[model samples]
Each structure stands twice: as structure tokens, then as C-alpha cells.
Target: MSENTPLPIVEEDDWYRDHLATVDEHGKRVWIYPKKPKGKFTNYRTVVSVILLVILFGMPWIRVHGNPLFMFNILERKFILFGSYFPPQDFHLFVLAMIIMVIFIALFTVIYGRIFCGWICPQTIFMESVYRKIEYWIEGDSNAQRRLNNAPWTASKFIKKFSKQVIFFSIAVLVANTFLSYIIGTDQVLAIVKDPISKHTQGFLAMIAFSFAFYGVFAFLREQVCTTICPYGRLQGVLLDKNSVVITYDYLRGEPRGKIHKAVKGKEEEAAKMNALLGDCIDCKMCIQVCPTGIDIRNGTQLECVNCTACIDACDEVMTKVNRPTGLIRYDSEEGIRTGAKKIMTPRAIAYTSVLGVLVLLEIILFATRTQVEGLLLRTPGMLYQKTDDGYISNLYNYQFVNKTSDTLALEMELIGIDGRIKWVGHAPIAIPNDVTEGAVFVELPPSELQTGKNKITLRVRSGDRTVDQVKTSFLAP
Candidate 1:
């Protein structure tokens, strides 16, 4: 430990570190054929994925207060959350919602690693649970798939490949329709489906493009989406720490691995007597076989690992068969595996949680206080007040009202502060439709109530007995 003593140079394992598992030194794509995984964790993930998928697909169809529960019509700058309508003016609420979601995801990653990517991500869920299952049914397990790929193009191969493609294409179309529903509402999507291609050319083309994109993603560009494309996967390196719980391999117990053999049956006692070194890992390689990302869990926490827990299940099954303790791989933190210390509430995690909590509270408050109607009243440009024969000063104004609710509203406007009478130019009571209504009105106030050339007027908008909105504008006076 002396200062004069030179530190030893350490060589890094560059083979696996230099390139992606799905690529080779020649830069060609190395297709992965992951063995189908099954265990308690996979079963739990399946249930969760199914529930999330149902919500994603069915939400567009569910109506709340006669409005689609969730719709983001970006083309028209309109968005609806729950039953509340948000126009271009309410874009702040949408931005706030997005910020809340980002903070929530960051906090979750700081605490629990990439559990969301593995269990609830739509890409993973549809790829593994749906498309991959279909592939397994048609092409069998990894070995069979590999064999089919290596074999010549025969009738059997053609039939299997063609059938799988047909089904995959159909599912992709369905997924595209579901995705379009979220953007433009299910009713619009149904109209596009029922009408001729010439009627809705853009929508029809969009549907076709989305279907092919989905097909290419699920069938060809599967794991690359997570490893190479997704920004969240790359962000794990910054968000995760020693305390973050992830699917980790217990290298302390499994290192210096040796293959199991018949000679090792009674060798445990002999090794113990001689102080011989031997670890629990038998090097079965089952974990690698079941990994969708094609990375070895024993190499430590890699970006490719989605925290899927497939390695844990595979390793546990192997350990049980060999009469060794399970959990050679498990859901644990780096510190837990290295020093046997489990801690979830680190200082960084606490900070993230605090910020996330505040954002969520702000969102709730914003939604609760949002008005059902919006109104804007302004004096007509370059217009002067006219003194009527009755000694009343009248100002010409234009009014615009936006109805956020689903029902038609017959609105009446009254001056709030001073004594004034509101007279609609065309109608006695202005009828505001569900979207937007514009009209002109004349506000006549007694000269005794007028202050100066420029006066502030408060207008109250009412629907029947309920006051809906209040708007303030400048009134011109001589």
C-alpha cells in the first residue's frame, strides 16, 4: 500500500464490451433465437401485460361523460383526458402530464431498474407475449427455429413461414387500428375502415404504413428496439446505481464455475476436506439460452438486460436439479450481491420520489380547477363609444366563447361591476355550441358609472342558474 508501489494494470474484457450481442465483428446482423421462457415470474408478467394491453386497446372505446376517455388528436390540436376537453389553449395541461410521466418513470428507474421495460412496455409485451408466441407455435423452440433457418427452402419451411407472416401481418393491422384509435378516436377509425379508400385517402395510407412498420418491428427488428433504439435503455447507465434493484447474477457464489459430472457426486466432501475451490454454478448455459437480448447475465448488469428475470428462472431450475441452492441469479441490487446489503431508500431515490410526488399533486390540482368553459371579450378595434339619446354610453365589443363540455350551452352575459346592459347584435341570448362560438355585442353603461376614456369591465357568462366563466376587458369611453 506504499505510494512508491506501482498499481497493476488491469485488462478489460473487450470482446463482449466492444460490440452489440446482435452484431458481429464483420458488422452483420446476428439474429437471436431465444428459447421460450416459462416460470412463476413469466406467468405474472403475462397477466400484467394482458391487463395493460386491454387498457391500451379498449380505452378509445370507453366513453366518459359522452366523450372518449382518452384521445390525442394532434392534427386538430385537441386532446381529451378522462372526460375533460383540452383545446390548443389548454396545451399546458398536456405538457404538465408529460412532465409528470417522465419524472415518475425516472423515479421508478432509480428505485427498481428497468422493470417497466420488461413487464409493461408495449413493445416487449406484444413481441414476447403475442408475436413470439405465434412464432413458437409455428416454428417451435429456439433450436427448431435455428434449424429451420439453416435448412433449404422446402415446402414445409415455406408453409410455416408463409402462415406465420400472414398471421403476423393480420395482428400488425389490428395493432395499427388500435394505435390510430388512440390518436383520432375509435369512431373516426371505424369510418376509415367502412368508407372507400378514395374518401379517406390519408387515413387509409396511414393505416397501411403503420401496419407494415409494426410488422417489421415485431417480426424483424425485435430486440434491437430495446438495445440500440430506445433512449430509456441507454439512460439506465445514468439512472441506476449500486442500490437499484435489478436482475443480477450473484458472481460471488457462482464464480470459478465448473461443469457438473458424475465424478463430482462425492467430491463435495473431499473438496471441503482439502479446502479445494468450487462454486455453485455448474455452467449449464441455460440462462444464456433463454435470454431474449442474447447477453450473459454472469457478465454483470448490461444495458441489454431488460430485468426480465428469465435468467433467474432458468438458473433456479438448473440449481434445483443439481441439488444446489437456488437464487444464483435473482432480483437484487449490486450492493446486495457484492456486500449482502439491501437498501431501497437511498438519498438520490428519496429526491426523485419527492419531485415525482410534487408533480403528481400539481397535476391533480390543475385538473380539479380547470373550467368547463372559456371566454374572451374585447372592444372592437378603432371603435369609439357613442353617446345615446338616453344619456347612456355604449361600447361595441366582440365576444368569443369556447365550450369545453359535451353539451350545448345557451349563455347569457351580464356586466359584473358597474350598472350596464348587454345587448346581442343579432340575438337576445347567445347560443354557444360545444366547440366555439363568436358574436358581437353592445355594452351600454350610464355616464354616471363611467370613469374615464379607458375603463375595465368584468363580464360574467352564465348558463341558466350556474355561472360558467368570467372575462375582463377594456371598455372605451369618451
Candidate 2:
């Protein structure tokens, strides 16, 4: 800011920029019009929306092994992810997964800034691209919505309002059902639908709860979901830097704006003021109207702005009409604008991206290395090895098996490392349940192989031709 530059009439206190930038003169949350976005970025957003829709709707239908590709049964403390089965014993893996996720989010925010808030976040996706677009279609654009809001009660108004509510709630319900599919699995969701109401009271209640929350949040809370609710939005200031790319006003190019008529049209001396001196902007306030968060980008970048680029489209439209070039407002940095420089890939960004890449690689490695089947063998406490009538030293042990695949497996245990032979006390081989762990079995070794005090042994469990699990335990010998 220069000494010649006039102070913002919107805020004129004896201080610097106000922290509460988005509040109106009355101190209420300023409602924004956000003139329908167009141009290159808007087109890019459409492609992303389609990809998200497909992934969200397709995940529950995907099956890996004999189980849903991903299912979180918190009630049972069981989870089947990818093709691997996990029980309570695998909780450490889950904790590690969550830690990785949090770190990834933080690192991403530190570099790319609010790209997640504007483009990738589910709340923004559903609100800006999906729900709001639907509303615009049904009720007409922003100005029409303003008129309808002010218009006295009428049949047309009633019809439009009723239709919007119905559609909003309907979509919310569908979203809830799709969300539930991830939790309980598509098969179970289908079962709940097919089963009698009496059989699924809890499921029905859960559906209701999800529907109400989704509907209320989208319909009523709306943009406040990002501003007031989202913890990430609150954290943007700390995560963001002046070098980060964000939707911003090129103050050097756009400042000293004046009315079109006052811009001096024909006279050579006056024409220079309109052409080169006066700047590209005409200060029509088109950008202000299109802001979702209702903060003027011209006031410098603020936390409230989600960087949706609605202002860019609106400003571009204004510039085209006024015979001036666009991008007075665009995805640029304050530093870039001040120095007349282009966006740069700074070292901070590179470092953050490198960290993200490493995290992703580690996640992939962990997933790949996860064992398909879980096996454990432990000697029964306070029990000594018994000599069987058949001249075998028998030791009671507990066996637990987790079948990672979709199909049931018939498995058998074998002994290795200083053992004569392995035999189950009862059943020779047992059927392992699919997507679950079943506990059973006892191991016996020939007396000829038994040591004095204790013998160390390795037990291998086999399914088909594959060695699914291996366990090491001490065999007690008296």
C-alpha cells in the first residue's frame, strides 16, 4: 500500500486490516452471489467432479478376496481392506495408516495452500459444483434467487422452494446411503433394504441419522461448513505463505481504478490514462458479487476466501465488456503480482511435495507388505507335554487363523525346526473361515524328538500350496 492510495471505505478504523473481513456493515455473515464460474479452471473442476462421483459410487461395489474392498466394522473391531483381512490384533497398522493420512494432509496444505479447500474437499465439491449448481438450474442464477427471496409469497415461489427442498433432501439421503455402504459394505446395505423393517431397526435409525445430518449440513450450513466447521479452513493461515498460489488481485495492475467515462477515452494525453496509466480494472465490483465467502480480493488475500475462482470468471466477464484484458483477478500470488513475476515452484513447495511423495511411497510399501493370512500359536499355560499311547509327546496349543481371501480355505499345520513330525490331536486338517479368524487345534511331536526342558519350534500353516502363516513357539518337554 502506498501513501497516495485511498483507504478502503469498507473498513476505516485507526488500524491495519481487520481480522473479520467477511462480515457486513451490520456485522452479519455476508451472503455471496458467486456468479457461475466459466473459463479454463471451471472446465478442469468439472472433470474432477466426474472422477470423484465414479470413485465414491464404485468403491462399495468392488470386492477383493471374498470381502468388500474396504469395510470398517467398528462394532466387531474387524476390517477388510484391499485383499487383506485385519482383526483387533492389527490395530497398530490402522493407527499407522491414520498417522500417515494426517501428515499427508498437513504437508499438502503447507505447500499447495487452499487447493484442497476449493477443489478436492468433499464439502466444497458437493456444495459448489453439485448442490449450488442444481439450485441455480432450478431457481435461475444469483439475481433471480435474490428476487425470489424478497418476493412476496406466491404459487411459483412456493413451487420452486418446495422443489428445491425435495431435491436437496433426496440427494442428501442418497449420499448418506452411499456413505453407509463404505461402513457396513454394499452387500449388507442391500440386505437391510431387502429385509423386513423389524429385522433392521438399528440400520434404519442410522440411515435416518446420516440423512438428517447430511441434509442439514448441506442445505442450511452451506458455505459455513468451510468457514465455521472445517478445522482445515481455520488452519489455512498457519499453513499458507505469501509465495503460495491463491486467487488474488494484481493490485499493481488493478489499482487506481476509476469509472469508464472518467477513464479519458479519445484525447491522446487523456487516452494514456485510460490505456496504460489507469490500469486494467474499472472497479465495477463484479468480482465482489461473485465471491463465495463475500470478501473482496482487492482488499488483499484473506483467510475467508476459498479461492474458488468465481471472481476470476466474473472479473473476466467485466473486463471483456469494458474492452480490457482479463486476469486482473486470477490464481496468482501477492509476491508475483507485486514484482510482475509469474508463479514459481519455490523450494518450500518442492520440499513439501517431496515429503508427500515419500509418504505415498511408504503407504504403498506397507500395503504391499501386509500379510494375507494371520497365524499365531501359543502353548497352553500350566500344562506340560504329555506322552501319548502312540509314543508321541503332545502339547496343547491355541491356534488362530485369519483367512484373507473371499473363499473358505481348508488348512493344516506343520512343524519345523527340531521336530520329528506334526499332528493335530483331533482333526487332521480344519476348515478356515473366510474373512475371519477361527481358533482351534493342538500340536504333538514324537517323544524321540523332545528335549529336556523346552524345545523351540516353528509352526507353518498351509492353505492349498501356499504357506499362509508361520509362528514360533516353545514346546514344553518334561
Candidate 3:
């Protein structure tokens, strides 16, 4: 074909585009039976999935500075990340961290498409590597699995189905326990497991509920979690652009597709001539068969595509067998495939990157400057100034101190500005517990040093010689 010559137009009915690949015209679910993928990329993904699984299941048991490495104990209104504890007072920091994570995900998605879903997502890792592999082992390949599902209730089919169910359920239970450990702590989880069901009824029920949810998702829901449920998959339309690198089919090199013909005795020259006019693609549908989400790469990028690179491996294998160059399906932007130009640093992607960097830096600064103790001082309600016997006006105030650190604090309140006295109702030096402490104190100021009406007074909370926290409250004065 000449450069000036137009490519052949392969027109087909657009009915397939009207609905999803995993659903029928009546909106019923269409079960996908994807052929097991095998290649260099698959092996690499297997290694990555194994590492991620180890981290996921082991993180709750791992401790840093006597605290779980990562935990979100929402019930107790406490959270810990990398050993740093975040109480309810520091909830804003958690919100900021979540926002930063969102920005990072957005930036990554704009540059790399949905590679995270395929490579690092927990659901994809467990489904494809663990559950799917087990299914293949017990029920054979895609064809065999389909046949077994469709066949009547036979002893062989029953055994395979029962075995797969048993394994999936057991794995789901383990997954649920690991998930709960991150929420309630591993020690509590172990205690619940060891204790009787009646002793920890709520925890037992929660574990059972989580186990069933996981089992249902991996066993029945499957790819619908990505295509229909997960918000990240839907966000691809907004986050991804033409410059984003994704698994794509090189239509420019593989189009005008034709089947390979065997060399015959009399038609050697004819077959060679025919092959010269055809593209590298042999019209093999191996790419479609290996797709987990059941979408054809040759049809262009679709929402159902997970960017798993399974199609790339499958297409490459077919190309090798046919003595053709590989990469009929590969990781390339749509712009690269269309204009033969690949650009990674688009303006939108750079803007997102810059915003994400700023957010991360701000979060780091916040964490660095955060105080270990929080103090609150407020004027007592419905109380006026009391004239003291020493010609001084005294204001009764309520104080609350929260200690975020693990150690207790010996706190003493001191007036910051003018010469004044802080007389605690109970004792001279107050001992603040690890969590929270509340008390009342009277701040007495002489009339010569005080202004009329309301006056601002600063109270400094000191532990030994170091001022740990400070607060300002309005004091009633005449």
C-alpha cells in the first residue's frame, strides 16, 4: 500500500457499542471466561502481586514505636500512620492526608492512565493472581471452565466446584481477618478469635460479615467491581487524556488485517504477493480471549479495558508464531498511535503534578509543626469578676488539656503578660494524664495592671521549664 493510498474501511454494526461487554441486551450479567494469560509481563505482575499481598496481610502485625504501622480505629476515634498517633483533635490532618492522596492519584492517572488498577490494586491482585489461578487449576482453562459450568450436575463437576468454593471461602475469611486487624488492631482481633462467640458477639458478627462480602465479591461480582462499581474506573474518562500512556492497539501498523496463508507448490509467488499487501496482524483473536474484562483492543480504548497488558502478551505470542514483528498491542498513547508522536509532559499533567507536590509539602510541614499537646482555656459561664481581699479582680476560668503523647505531663499554669497569680482550685501543680484532663482555676490580676471591661489574658502551660502549650481567654475586668 502506498502512503497516499487510503486504508481499507472495515465497517461493522455499532450495536456492540450500545451496551457493556459484561451485560446482555436485557441487562442481565454476562459471565466472562477469559483464557489464562502467560508471558513475561504476567510473570512480572505475579511478583508484584505477591509483594503487595505480603504487605497487605502483614502491615497490621508490624509495629513502629510501639504502635501499629498503619491503623484506622474509627470506633475509638484514633488513627495511626507510621507510628504517629492521630487523635480526634488531629482529624483535620487525616482529612488533609486524604486530600493529598487524592491529588496524587489524579496526577498519576493523568499520566499513566489506569495502570495502578492493573498493577497495584488489591482487588485485581487477589482476583487475577489468587482466585483466578486457583480456578484454572481446579476447573482447567477458560473453555473447560465454561463447559463445566454449563454441564449437568455430575460428580466430576461437583468435586471441582466444591473444591474451588472451599478454597475461595477460606481465603476470604483470612482476608477479612486481616482487614479487621487494620481497623481494630491485631491484638484485639486475636483476642476475639480466641474468646467465645458470646464474649465478643459484635466482633464475631463483623468478621463473618466481612468474610461473606469478600467471598461474594471474588466469587460472583468479579470484574463488575472494576467496570461498574469502583469510582476510580469511571474517573478514567475525566482523568485520562490522549497523551496518557495506556494499553492500546497499533491500528496504523496492524490494520488492513488478513489471515496467513501456507506456502503451496504452485502458489508460492501468489502467496508472497498477497502477504506483501497485508499488515503484520494475522487477524488472530488471541488478544480478545486473554482479556480479563472481555473487551477487544482492536476496537480502540474502552471503559472495560483494565490496562493489564494481558492483551499485549497474547498478541506478542501470536506475532512470534506467525514470524511477524510484535507490539500489535502495546503501551502507547492514543496520540502516539494516531500521529506517531508520544508526549508525556502535557500541560494538564504538569499542572496536576505541581499541585500534588505542593499538597505533599504542605502536609509534611503540618506534621512537622504539629504539637504533642493541645490546651483549651475558656472563661467560666455566667460568672462575673470577684473582688479579692488584696484589692485584685479575679476571674474563674475552666481549662482542659489533651495530651497526644504516650507520657503523662506535670503541668503548671503561668500568666504570660502582666504580673498575676493562677490559683488552681485543687493543687499547685496539676498532673495531666496521657489522654485528657479537665480542671478549674482562678486568674487574679491587680486593678493597677488591668484595663476596664474585657481584657485578653494569655495562659502558658509549662512542663518543668518548657512551655508545652498556650491559650488566650478574655478576662472580665473593671
lDDT tens digits, residue span 1-478, model 2: 9979975774453222654544565668756556667767777887888798888888889876567888787876768777456776777778778877777776666555687877888888888888888889988888998899889999999999999999999999889988888888787788777899788899988988999999998888777777777888888878777777788898888877766644335576675545555667787887877677666788877777887877888888888888778888988777777887765567776776787678777777876776657777777777777887878787887766666566577787777666555656566545454445545466777767777888888877788798877888888877
lDDT of each candidate versus the true structure:
0.88, 0.76, 0.88
Candidate 1 Cα errors over 4 Å, as ranges: 1-12, 264-276, 428-434
Tens-place lDDT per residue, model 3, 96-171, is 9899888888888888889999899999999999999999999999999999989999998899899999999999
Candidates' TM-scores?
A: 0.93, 0.87, 0.93
The ten-residue window of minimal lDDT in model 1 covers 7-16
Q: What is the Cα-based lDDT of residue 465 in candidate 3?
A: 90
Give the alpha carbon lDDT tens digit for every residue of 59-178 in model 1.
889998889998888887778888677877678888998998898898899899999998989999999889999999999999999999999999999999999999999999999999
- Flag regions of model 2 displaced more than 4 Å: 1-30, 64-66, 88-91, 262-277, 340-347, 390-392, 428-434, 446-454
Leading candidate by TM-score: 1
Candidate 2 clashes between residue pairs 3 or more apart in a chain or in different chains: 65-406, 66-406
Q: Model 3 clash pairs?
A: none
Worst 10-residue lDDT window for candidate 3 reads: 7-16
- Indicate whether candidate 2 or candidate 3 has the larger lDDT: 3
